[model samples]
Target chain A: MHLLVCGGTGCRASASDSIVESLKQELENKGLSDEVQVIMTGCFGFCEKGPIVKVLPDNTFYVEVKHEDAVEIVDEHVIKGRQVKRLLYQDPEKKQSISDSKHMDFYKKQIRIALRNCGFIDPENVDEYIGRDGYMALGKCINEMTPQDVIKEIKDSGLRGRGGGGFPTGLKWEIASKNNADQKYVVCNADEGDPGAFMDRSILEGDPHAVLEAMAICGYATNASKGLIYIRAEYPLAIKRLKIAIDQAREYGLLGKNIFGSDFEFDVELRYGAGAFVCGEETALIHSMEGLRGEPTIKPPYPAEKGYLGKPTNVNNVETFANIPVIINKGANWFNKIGTEKSKGTKVFALAGKINNVGLIEVPMGTTLREVIFEIGGGIKDGKKFKAVQTGGPSGGCLTEKHLDTPIDFDNLIAAGSMMGSGGMIVMDEDDCMVSVAKFYLDFTVEESCGKCSPCRIGNKRLYELLDQITQGKATMDDLQRLRNMCEVIKDTSLCGLGQTSPNPILSTLDNFWDEYVAHIKDHKCPAGQCKDLMKYVVIEENCVGCTACVRVCPVGAISGEKKQPHYIDPSNCIKCGACIERCKFDAIIVK
Target chain B: MSHIKVKIKEKDLNTIKQICKSFNNEPKELINVLHKTQEHFGYLPAEIQEVVAQELNVPVAKVYGVVTFYSFFTMLPKGKHPVSICTGTACYVRGADNVLQEFKRQLGIEVGETTEDGEFSLSCLRCVGACGLAPVVLVGDKTYGRVAPDGVKAIIDEYKK
Candidate 1:
């Protein structure tokens, strides 16, 4: 039986590397090292229960496997062919252990298109990638099909850009092809700057060769000889894996001159994005690649006509590119039949924040939020009520329980007041404050604002100040009106996509959770109890035994009372550190 | 943006020149050059920026603009063990703010400030892509996952030696 261990960043952080080392060492000790080959692969998307180890042939899937469990895994599972009962994924609801992951509902509703080879193949080994028809599409495009035919195949596939904007990918390639420039460029936008989104990073980390191969295919279709992957510097692991994949592709003559023994040459270079959120925009990305400040320019001269040193360029998101090879391999008719009428394929979502199954998931276009959250995601964490789910990161808005049944797609999300951003589906529960959540997004947009335009740079800052006032319980209803008006103006006048969608969080929250904002404004009370400025740390008379624990624990000396008597927390001096609450045995100190 | 600079020794100047030369001193390689220089030196001070500007044949103001534009480049030097707390949306919702507040309380330093002893410097990052461990902390190259406000002291106490 073969062992596949998750080497994704999430698993790596939990010392999945040591788990592999111990597994290999233990296997050697048992003289079964050759018999049982341990392969370190990419993310399985079930990151909540990582580092995951899947035993092949029998299909025994293990979750949260520790390094010390290596001996048991090798001794019990691999040796005697008996599955490790405890290591198997225990269903949170039924509390029954699931041996084969194929039966789990987590993997059932999900249809992985872009993430087809992610958890299945070893990212470092090019042979494994090729074994699964990796570069067959590239060869087919170069030899069997013409550029026009290839573009037509993509167009017929009904694939749209997965990077927030659902622009037609084939139309973009056709435009770049028609530009007739002396030099053209194919850019793979791996700069996933969305705060909670990591699907792009996971794709690059798990299947780096897929992106490289797709970039080559894009280069052939667009007549671009050079490709640049503008990746985020924050993703060091993705960058490392991409570098390895590029080197391996070059060694195998898949990326270098005359790829697949054809004249259609394509090579990729890595351009590091040094923490600029605006760089995710096509214009800003091209400027950053030219070693300039990542500022967005007007869009009439889109990147298709002028980009990357003033040459014709086609920029596609990483997930979008990861879908190209699949669409090329499977006919457009086959791929288009899966999703909704408009959106044609599965989208990878980094499902996180107050969710039980906080992991990466890829589901088809028409999959409702209720299905993704309740079924695939295993519902909200700690049995909390599902408050809202934030998709498309800062650019996208907060989708509430009412919209959970809405089918998730590019058009559906936009119609529901949110757009399909880089697919960062952050589920927020009742404990999370909507007013504070809006303030959080406003804060991010204010910091990330490029200061190029007045509306986005200054108006966003003013909006943040307004949010601050609301959260601090100092805002009037007039300030709330101003916040709404400002969000509209910024969206209408942003020079780039960053400023345009920056106010989405505010607009979305105001649209869905208007009561939360009103509570923070009118009553000067935060319904979620998240606004510390409005909270009062009160000592309950009966529970407070005046044990002096809270008084001693209060760092600001806010609590004072007689020993064995009830204590009182002075509101003026209370810092809301919650230290007294932690120290109190009776749980008397409560925030209201 | 802070514009902090230290005295640049002659050998340091040579190192900056060499880094620029390795990338053929291309103006387009400015970001890459700065990344390499910062890897060699702990931080990118004004003196190093000037030397990089002169070698790359770009204005010093341009280098500073590029340096300040990206959050990765820093003008001030970081402590030996720079502690980073992820303040991404995932971590933020999972109570990263309380953990950050706890770190500041224990270290007696603000987000961009270093401890007086220069042992640890605290900073907030967007995300490390480890959403499974929502409130993630990074000390040097080592990653600490699912970090809580109560676990801040034990993490800092690790590098006490």
Candidate 2:
């Protein structure tokens, strides 16, 4: 039996490496090392209970396994032929032990098309990747199908770019192919600059071969011989794995000239993004690859027509490319049947924020927000009331309870004042303030703004200043009107996607939670008490034990009382830092 | 300003060539060249940026835009170590603002400013994705989570050591 240990970056940080070592030592100690093989693989996606271990052949899944528990697992499960019931994942809802991953609610709803090889294969091993039809797509494209045929297949598959824009992949390839250029290029926008998004990075880390093969296929389809992957320098692990995969591909005759003994030649290279959010845009991304300032230029001659060294180019994000091989291998007709008519196939989301199952998830296109949040995400954390879900990172908008059942697709999301951004779904609970959420996105846009255009640079700044005023409880109703006006102007006048969609959070929150803004302006009160400037901290006389916990923790010296008496918080001096409230054992300090 | 006609200096050119050679003519070496040039010149200049594009056989526009897109990179010169303060919800709730204030007070520079001595550059991040250990500040590669206002100096001092 083989013991597959999760070696994904998340589990790695939690000393999953040590667990593997300890398991090896324990297996040796128990004289079961020869019988049992330990294999380290990528993420299982059920990260809420991670550092996981699955005993293969029998498929006994163990969740939240620590370094100390390695001995018990080997001793009891490996040697004795008995399962470690305690080490197994216990479903909180059912209150029963789950032995296999297929039985878990988190895995039940997930359709792992893009992430098929993520949990199963060793990412660094090229042989394992090939064993799962890794470079077969490249071979099929080069030897069997022509550039036109491949593009037509992608068009038939109805594959839209997964990089938030949802542009037709085949159409993009066709544009570049039709454009007459001596030197054509294919670019992969791996610069995943979204705040809560790690879907691209995870794919690169887990299945770099998938992207490499897909890029090769794209090169054949677009008649581009060279490809470049513009990834952020911050993703050291993803970069390393991608480099290894590239080198391995070249060595295996899959990357360099005469690939799989075919005439079509295609190879991929990497360009490191300095971590700019705007560079994720195609025009800006192409400019960055050309060694220029990573700023977006106006479209007339789009990137497909005049990109990279004034040559015809096609650019798609990492997740978009990850879907290509599947579309080609499984046939377009099969993929077209999965999701909505317009948005075919699955979407991979970095499920984050207030959700319990906070990890990477790939669900079908038409899956509702309620299903993603409750059924797949395991609902809001700590049984907190669901407030709103922020889809599409900084570029996307917030969806309220009223829009929970709205099917998540390219058109549906856009209709709801939000776009399907690079698939960053940050679930927010009732404790989260909607106004503050708008401010948070605005702040990100303002900082990342390239200052190339007036609408983006000045407009975003003015909107942020307005948000700051609103959060500080210093804004008038006139200011609210100005904020909305500014959002519309910026959305309309901005040059690129970054500036155009910068007001998404503001518009979305304003659409759903207009009353919250009114409450902040009229009542001068933050309902969630998130805006500290508008909140008041008071001591509950009945609950205070006067144990001096608040006194010791108070950084601003806002609380005062004798050891035995009820402690009083001086609201005038209090900065609303929440230290006293957190330190209060008796729950005396209450935020009003 | 004057289209500068900015030809690569011999020394800088040699450095660029050597860096390009190290990556073995792979177009992917464009970022490495830019990074190394940035390290040499403090920030990416038009001349160095041009040298990189020419070396990698990539467009100059592509290099320039990439340099501006990412937060970790800079076109302007910065101090030695970048000290980034986490201002996410968890960190903000735990008095990260005061910690940032303390850094500004101690370093005599605001967020995104490099100290006069070129010792440290302070900046604020959305979140480093480490919330359990809130109020975090990252100096170079070391992350000091649960950092208080009073602990800022000591943390910087430890980095110095």
Candidate 3:
């Protein structure tokens, strides 16, 4: 039996590392060290119940295991081959312990294609990666199939780019393959800058070899001699693992030159992205890789034709490249039948915000928002009323309750006023204001705008100003109409994807929650009480018993009262810090 | 702006030269060289940018432009223990803003500014991908997760030495 402990960053922060040491010490004390192997693995996806340890061969999953429980696990289970009842994953609905993870509600509707090797193998050890059919696809592609055949198989598989755009992956390869360039390049866009998304980072940390192998396969297919992974410098763990994977692949002769006795020469180099969100755009990414300002230029000659130092280059996101090796190994026919009609295969999402299960989930393309939010996500946190679900980060929009049943795909999400952008699905509750949400996204876009385009740089700033006016209850009804019009103009005239989709959040929020916008402007009240400038902290007369606590805590001296009388709040002086409310013994202070 | 001659040590300058040489002195490797240079020296100053510009044979304006365009490249030096609070959408919804404000109030410095003594500096990162540990605060490389406003004092106290 093997003990697989979660080694993901989330679990590591929660002291999962110490849990591993304790488990190892216990196993050694019992003289069962050789019999039971303790291996630290990647995220199990059910991070809500993290610090998970799964006993293999019997498939017993123990959720929320502590360091002290390590001795009990080895003493009871490992020694006597008996299962620990209390440590098993308890089903939320049934309120009963589940011995096997297969029956859990979270993993029921999911398909783990892109995340196949994520939680299973030791990423540091390439032999373990090789043990799980790691390089079979690259070997098969080079030894048996031709470059054209590899491209055709990817074409038939119908795998689109997982990065915001739904462009066909194989068609991109075919274009680059057709281009006659002495030096071509394949770039892995691991600069995952989406605010709440981390699917790429998790994949790189969990399975670095998969991306390296896929890039090599791409190198063989596109007739490219060199590959560059333009990953973010912020992802120190992913970069470290990629370096290890690259060095290991070189040692194994899978990456250097003439692999499997064939004349395919491919080597990869690492380029760091210095925290520019606009680098997610292809042209800007290419420019950033070339050590220039990461600004986007007009695209008549796409990156397929002329890119990365004016050579034929193909850029695909980390998640998109991860699916390449799988499609090659499992045949096109087998991979094509999984998802919806147009969008074939699964999409990995970093499901976060107000959701009960805030972690990475890989679901089928045609799965509905209702299923994802209710089933896979385990519904909203603390039983809060679900108001909207924001998909695609700043480049995407919000979908409401009416659109929950809509199937999630490239076309379906676009039809529902959102796009599948890097798979960042942030669920918002009733307490989250739509106008503030739009303003938040607009704020991100304004900061991230490369200033290369006039509309995105200037228009987005004006749009943010308009949002600032509305959120502060300083805008007239006319400004709402102006906000709508400005979103359209920015959408139409932007230079790249960043500006084109920057207005999506505003437009979608306007369509779905126009009343919220009116509440902030006409009523002079923020519906969600999020905008501090619009909120008025008032001490309720009936509940206030004149404890000078509020007076002492108020930073601006906004509250004053006698020793026993009810306290009164000076609204103008109140900075809306909510300090008075926390200090009050009775629930007297409330924001209006 | 007044011209300042901020001196760089000879050894550090040689390291930067070696880094540029590793990339064949190609102007295209400007961003890569800057990354390595910044890693060696905690932050990039104006003087180092001039040296990088001369070494790679690119214009100083271009190097400065590349440095300013990316958020990761910093012109101002970070504190001894830089405090990065994640303000990503997930952390935002989970009350990371309050934690950030609490730190600012305690340190008497706003986001992106260092204290007078240079003990700590405050900045907001997009996301560190530790969503399960919402409202994460990083002091140097140590991560403090599920950080509440009340927990801010203890964090600062630990780094007081």
User: Which candidate tops DockQ?
Assistant: 1
DockQ for all candidate structures vs. native: 0.82, 0.23, 0.78
Q: Model 1 over residues A60-117: C-alpha lDDT tens digits?
A: 8999999999999999888887888989899887989989887898999888889999
**Model 2: lDDT of residue B1:** 18
Q: Which 10 residues in a row give candidate 3 chain B its minimum summed lDDT?
A: B1-10
**Residue A174 error for model 1, in Å?**
0.3
- Give the better candidate number (1 or 3) by DockQ: 1
Q: What C-alpha lDDT, on a 0 to 100 scale, does residue A56 get in candidate 1?
A: 85
DockQ (0 to 1) for model 1:
0.82
> Per-prediction fnat values?
0.72, 0.23, 0.75
Q: TM-scores of all models? A: 0.99, 0.88, 0.97
- Clash number for every model? 0, 29, 0
Worst 10-residue lDDT window, candidate 1 chain A: A256-265
| Alpha carbon lDDT of each predicted model | 0.91, 0.83, 0.90
lDDT of 2: 0.83
**In model 2, what lDDT does residue A386 have?**
91
Residue-wise C-alpha lDDT for candidate 3, range B48-104, written one tens digit per residue = 998899999999999999888999988877889899999888888888888998899
A115-211 in candidate 3: lDDT tens per residue? 8887788788899899989999999999889999999999999999999899999999999999998899999999999999999998998899999
